[model samples]
Target: MNHYRQIAPRSKEAGGQLFAQFEGDDTIIVEATPPKWCDRRNRYNFHPSRWLQQQEIRKRYSCGLHFVGDWHTHPEAAPQPSQEDYRNMQDCFNKSIHDLNRFIMIIVGYAEAPEGLHVTLIGQNSVQLMFCENNL
Candidate 1:
């Protein structure tokens, strides 16, 4: 989370893919791949290239881990997801290649060194929001 500050000077958001594995029915998030932010600023878009790269990451882990969702840094003390977030999640839910029924989004807020991290689990008709302080 602290690394997000490297790009905070622009006020543009940074984003990437969330990689995870499962044990029984419990999902264990284990990795995140941070790619270069595309041309668009102020918003995070997991473009097709990002998704394709995630596929390689999944393969690198021998399919044990897969793309589960996404994460991004917001320029706020308390990040309020824009309509773009909703559209992204909905699009992911519909077409994500993984065998996931729910997707997780980690929204990191811009603050001092360590920021606040918000995690939202999104299903077809359900949404669960969780939060944690970025001590790092």
Candidate 2:
């Protein structure tokens, strides 16, 4: 629970300029990046390594804190994790020793409109969709 609090802030701001907000405990940690830049296309790229580094930095900084959860954003919608997102979650869990703790994955999508964010929690081998408004 404590770790969750610490990691919430990072989730809130995980997507470049977009905002990620988490409620629970009192600590929130966020690992975010500006929109990626593409040299050839002159566009943006989602760099997974950068995000992972952010998480590692957060974990390192909050040594005693609990590893609550994490999230990312989509340009247009709220947030939702993709298949790659799930793989990243699994990779994070597999590489860490905090498997016993609950981990969350959030994806900000842009399906219909802006300001749309979706959150999900993954444990063991199961995944559950979560509502940020509910905060449960």
- For each candidate in turn, the TM-score is 0.74, 0.50
Clashing pairs in 1: none
Regions of model 1 farther than 4 Å from truth: 6-9, 37-39, 42-51, 57-63, 112-115, 132-136
What's the true lDDT of residue 26 in model 1? Answer: 84
Candidate 2's residue-wise lDDT over 1-136, tens digit each? 1121113323322333112234564335444333334211111224445555556546654654445555555443344456877877767666756534446665555343233556666676777776643343
Query: What is the alpha-carbon RMSD of candidate 1 to the true structure?
Result: 4.0
lDDT of each: 0.67, 0.47
Residue 28 displacement (Å), model 1:
1.4
